[model samples]
Target chain A: MTMKRLINLKRTEARRIFITYSAVVIAYVIFQVMSSSGFLSSSMRGMLVPICAYMVMAVSLNLVVGISGELSLGHAGFMSIGAFSGVASAILMQSTITNAPVRLALAMIVGAIFAAIAGFLIGIPVLRLKGDYLAIVTLAFGEIIKSILNNFYFGVDAQGLHFSMLTDTTRLLKGGRLIIRGPMGISGIMKIATFPMGFILVMISLMVVFNLVNSRSGRAFMAIRDDRIAAESIGLDITKYKMMAFVTSAALAGAAGALFAMNYSTIVANKFDFNTSILILVFVVLGGQGNMLGSIIAAAALTVLPEKLRGFSDYRMLLYAIILIVTMLGTNNAEIREFFTKLNPFRRKEEA
Target chain B: MTKRIFTCALLILAMSSCAFGAPFKLGGTAPLTGGAAIYGTAARNGAAIAVEEINAKGGDIQFELRYEDDTHDAEKAVNAYNALKDWGMQLSLGSVTSKPCEATAAENFSDRIFALTPSASSAAVTEGKDNVFQMCFVDPNQGTASAQYIGEKGFAKKVAVIWKNDDVYSKGVYDTFIEAAPKYGLNIVSDTTFADGNDTDFSVQLTDAKDKGAELVFLPMYYQPASLILAQAQAMGYAPKWFGIDGMDGILTMEGFDKSLAEGVMLLTPFNADAKDELTVKFVAKYKEKHGEIPNQFAADGYDCVYAYYQALTQAKANADMSAEELCTKMIEQFTTMTFNGVTGENVKWSANGEVTKDPKGMVIKNGAYVGLD
Candidate 1:
């Protein structure tokens, strides 16, 4: 009887994964149909890549904030780092690599690696703090990153890499081309990120977050989140699990950033400042801290909502605020809470 | 069932009315309600007045002006552009600012859509785009003109440059000025910079210029900061010949600004509100009547953009039932060769690359109002 129960539980877990994957695929196919058939407006169609990037950001942030139970206010900093690094790599590789897809893939990998390294370095010192302390440090880091980018000028050519800070003292090799010009930022970036590439990235981000949330390490993360002292006494390595979640989250955010950077011809550091970090946090919070699918839905809806409401013109922002408040209230109200409880896709057997 | 049928009939009638309207619809995106709303409001008012006058004349074509607020954001500007495009708008006056114009014009990769901006001076706004045009001079032209005018008049041999380091417009103009200064026999003695917003304390930079014996200070920023610099310089009793760009056009009328602070402040502008020409008199009076204030350079540019479009259409001999794509092609062909005298009181000509070739007039503030110097 015990063996059969374990087998049935495994089957349910597998079934749950199947359901989420199918849901994402169905939604994507439906969007493609609507876009091609002219049922969706061009404004809505233009938002496909941004929605995907924000979804990845929301889900990855859900890993650290929801499952691991840590608040990070500097997600945009990691994203900026990824954007600059990825764009730098893509610009450097463009002349040599003829194929656009391969270059984009390499750029994303570079972005993710650099962002993971930054997260590791930051997580070592910051993971020791908890609550508001961690939040403040992360916020400061975001500001610091933006200030640094504001002064950073970079180029690449025969010299391999040339850089300067707030001055034109750059020493370039022969035939070197300047890529970044401080506040003017990286212009003329090749637009290689399309809906299909963005869709693949969202899948990768969801896969990482979902699988990690179900693994043994994920249980330890939740234990620490529930009671830190109890988790420590139970012989769980608290920092190890926290760092794992944070670094993975940062890496996924980096990939999202790379996708975002390719969508624009010119991007500046101001585009990824403190407000952006707060915006992403709002997405994670409103989506339900631990809900991956909710984050995806919330991110996509919020990104497209303001654009669809642009006809109102003067009252666009006012209507946006009203919709946000109503949705938040509806999701948190007692009756709706009960409804959502019944619809929870990841509810365990005991909860059922 | 009867109620449902009634609702369905009403919806169908509403849809048909929208589909059958045959007005020449033009759309635009502007800041409308943000830090840059002053410019956006002025641009919209100018365009609105032009459309009203054009329609009132009862030509064969009736024009409609539709605009969406971008809030000075690039992404929002692109969103506005796409929304308008989806609604069957093919010709647009793109966003008011450089970044938003760049964003909106990127969507015009195919020549199927045409964009004409009023006040975005950045050269990148039309870079690599065949269908995009600007009504204002590019930054390099404006900057070079200022330098040449100052040099020829021998205003000052020792000049100092102060600009906003974080702004693309300020940087573009400042860099060109720096490159053109030596050619004009002016020495840039003290080159200093300040960050945008709330960094209003210019005492250090001013003292540096004063101590360096700088006779002129070139400010390539907007009027708000320029006002602060003037006030602070007065407090310090360090007065230099202040020169600014078109961004300084509204300084004399800034609320709470002492009129004396602008006594000798000179700027490069294409529009002279004091011009007594017939078009200038009529446009200024009409704009003042409509907006309760004198029209700024941006407003003048906006007014000119509409007339330029009308001229291009007329020259192309565009008629109803001309496909938007065909009309865009003809407009581009005609716009490249058309020249006109407009409300700005300058003879306007556009190059193939969409650069405007109207020379800016140098104006100075006297007794708290603009007086043309040349």
Candidate 2:
């Protein structure tokens, strides 16, 4: 009986992964066909890359909030680090890297590395706190990152890259290009991010998250999340697992940031703020904790919902708030949950 | 046979509808529900009034304006721009703020849509976008104009500058003001800077300006920080001739602000609501009746943008059926060559680089109202 139950669990996991992957692939194919055949509106076409980026963000954040059971309010901070560093590296490589895809890939990798380092550093002290304390500290860290980027000035000249704080382009030599102008941010960026690249990034993020969640380290993370005392009694290094999940999440968020930043011609530090962090958290919560496929759907749907309500004019945001409230309430309603379960054909087969 | 006849009738109806005219679709994005909602709401209202009047005029040209809220965010502004594109917008008001305008202006340039922003003063909005134009003075233009006015009018010789360093609008004006001050023979006594999260107190900055024996203090920031500085200066008993740019225009209407503190303060703006000109009077009356408040410079800028577009569209003989790309080309040609007279200015013209050529009027606040300085 135990062997049969184990097999059943593995089968369910495999099916979940297959369904998620197929959903992404099918959605991509449908969108591509629609866009090429002029069936998709320009608005929907513009949102494709951002939707993919947000899906990655939601999944990575779910690793920390859902799997690791640590509420992080500074996800956008790591993203900002990734975005600025990626932009800087891309601008620096403009002459050497003529191919847009190669340049964008290298930039995203650089961004991921920087974000991972930042995550490791912040996670060391941040992991000591629990619950609300961790959330507050992360919030402060996010604000600190935003303030730093606001005063950060970077430029590249014949003398190489110039970095400064609290000073404008006057420090840079003449004829040098200012890549990041303090609060003005980086403008005139070549939009190199494509929907296909976004898809690949999302897939990579999903694989990392899924594989990590199924690994021994992921079990240790869940063990700590369920009961820290019991996890510690089992000789588990709580700090190590927590830090592992955090750094990995941060790195993925950084890659998503790079993808998101490259889709726009201009980007500013203000794009990633405390509000953005909360937005990703909302995606995780509404999608259901520990549910990867749900995160992708929630991210895409929420991102498109606002644009879809444009016809409502001034009442757009109000209607959005109402819809969100109703969704939250409905998800929590036991009757609604049972109804959804009844609607699932797979569940029916299991019951039979 | 009946179904075929019905289908033929529907096709003919569609073709006839296409043959006739419809209102030209105009779209804009604004911060209608955020920190800068005042400016955005005012601009939207001002544009709506213009659209209503034009449509009521029963002329060859009519406008259908649609505005989406961006909450003063660049990302949301791009999304709003896309929605407008999907709605078949042929013309745009870019955005109501500088950062968002900069983002949307890039889209306008790439998509070949003509844009005229109401109050995005940042030069970056029109820097490399020939298709994007400003209805207000560019930041550098405002800075130089302020210096020239102060120098020629002999307002004060010793001036101290306090600006927000982290704001592109403030920094842009400050950079140009510093460059032009020397040409006007104005002596700079002190200079100070502040950033976003540190703008609450102004005691330190005011002390420096006061210690330097400055006769005039130049503030190149929005009304929020300016109000704080004004209150702080009054508390410290450091009174100087306060000079401000167009960003200071709304201080009087700010909630919880002491109106007495703003007496004798001067600002450089393109529009004066108190002007007795026929256009100004009519617009002010209409705006007051609709918005229930005095119209700010942003409202005038929005009003002038529509009128300028109206003049251009009339000159080009543009019809509603033209594609946005075709309209863009025509707008580029017409704006570059045509002269416009509106509530904001007389004989306003745009250069090829999308900068407007208009005179900045200096007005001083007296008895809780703006009075013409000249």
Candidate 3:
């Protein structure tokens, strides 16, 4: 497809975009109003928040896996670090620091930074590995993180060994007993997550990813995806650009994680598993690798689909796999592309 | 290409409908088919049963249950959180233990949604959480509940607590047992921790438990480990009463457990569906009628919570005289009297900490079935 034809596809694409954006906004507003109206139960109303967060995670991870052509199963590690940093910071603000929106913003930034550091740490050694090797490395990274978090002592000893699962909300100083209770988890967190907060943060993350993917850094990464040796032959910094993609992907995952903590009140170790990392990658793949809007749409759809199909309990996963396979087969087939080409009358005229 | 577009569009439209006005949406994250799949799948079934039961009761409310596969990972659960939050689900469920719940709390489950984990028993989930409303008890609560039962019965003066360090849930329970043992005046002379869950040759651990002057050894693990550890403990001639936790609830009914290895063993939980209680008879029959089998406590609690959400909404119905805040107050007020007469017993009330505090009926391993303990 020529640039002109592709650019012209924007017209039809614009309509799709409008439909999607409208659907999301309308659905979000409708749910919020209904929930606030006391029409639904507190638990059902509560599910909306996570659905939005997952959409963002799905979209951001897509930027790396889909756009940059790298399989990163370790993104959850960065997210975990980000969650602790963000939540710990937010906890500090609620307890010791002066409470303000700036505190949350700063905490989110720090949390993203923490996640970025993690991404860099992992990316430094393993971005060189491709395909299954890369997947295995990333998967191992996730497992290692789980082990560490399972064993993490978020508190210190007598030298002010800050302890307790209630990081800082609820009862800050309780009966001289600081429950650094390592495995217990960080509890008593503040829930500052409103739809507006989650919406804005997600928007920013989406925007950042969108903008980055269109930049020179993006092209380099895309080139790396096409042919790393060829791109490197032209003196493209494969190591740097790959690491860049890895770091940015981690940063977004971390930001989402931090926002997650900000929305909820506690943290546990089991929440970030290898399967989750793979699921995010699934979004990137299912969304049409390298397509931004595709990822967003996929994320939103997957989030709500399983819930709607909750009635098909055991068959739920079967449906998910089916959907993934069908979509992949449907899109990647040459016959389908040929059919579309034949349908488009403007296509043959271009060669003429 | 055309088909992909059509399919995607159709999916988009369908998903929006599910998100907009579905009733009783229970958002839960579990390791549906992973290492924790045994428990996770059962928990998923528990959730599925709850959804089925609620809808079957004349389809009471207009709520939907949105389940996100957390794969038991905390970070990915953040996505589950976002998905649940975006969909505006009321109550969140699933995640059998601390990891996902911890990830959930970290991801902000407390503010966005009222979480009631049917299986998570980590002490961290309840210690300070106001929004984490777990349907099940925490480690300390479950541990103490069991300890009190064991101690009250004067089960033994000396106890050997065998646990695996690799698993946080096991460790948390053991830690609580250790702390509560001193209170109960039980001498925990021998506490052995294993490295792997698959290590069936617990000769060293069993030997240690035996040497520690154990009258009973508390082994809290899954079916495979529990069976392996039990056989090893028996072969070692330890003969200490093999006391464990709910892990053995259903295992008692499983055939793999040698009857010789299982006699006189005690396990503890609040409710077992096999019990002959009035609630148990009805709930189990109803649940089995729908799901085609006996429901575990997880399934029962999930059913109760989902229905409870409907009940709460009905009571919370924006009162004509009251504002939204007043309506919430009314709902919260009405929720207090809410007694879910599920296959388990009543779980209608929420504690000050937002956790369900009603005790489950007791169970003990007899042959392999988790028979009700009198």
Name the top DockQ candidate: 1
- State the lDDT of candidate 3 residue by residue for B1-374, as single tens digits: 99999999999998676542345455777666555555665666656665665565643355456666666555445556656666655556645656667767544433544566777777666556445566676666666766777787788888887776656577667767877877787888787765442366778888887777888788766556777787877676678777777666555434456766777777776667667777567767776686566666666655666656666666666322333234334544555566655554564467756566676556666664567777
The candidate with the higher lDDT, 1 or 2, is: 2
Tell me the docking grade of candidate 2.
medium
Q: What's the CA error at residue A37 for candidate 1, in Å? A: 3.0
Tens-place lDDT digits, model 1, residues A1-352: 2344335446666655566677778889998889889898878888898898899899989899999999999999888888888998999989899798888888888889988998998899899999999999988877777777777889876757888999656767778877887777777778887888888898888888767877789889999999999999989999999999999999998888888888877777878888889888889988889888778888988898888787787888899989999999998899989897788766676876
Q: Per-residue lDDT for A248-293 in model 2, tens only?
A: 9999999998889988877888789899999999999999999999
Candidate 2 runs further than 4 Å off:
A1-9, B1-20, B186-190, B211-214
> What is the clash count for each candidate, in the order shown?
0, 0, 77
DockQ for each of the predicted structures, in order? 0.53, 0.51, 0.10
Model 1 captures what fraction of native contacts?
Answer: 0.51
What is the full ranking by DockQ, best candidate first? 1, 2, 3
DockQ head-to-head 1 vs 3, winner:
1
B244-341 in candidate 2: lDDT tens per residue? 99889888888899999999999999999899999999999999999788888988988988988999999999999999999999999999999998
Task: Compose the digit string of candidate 3's lDDT tens values, residues A271-340.
Answer: 6666567767677777777665567667667766665554565577689778878877986899996787
Q: Write down the DockQ of candidate 3.
A: 0.10
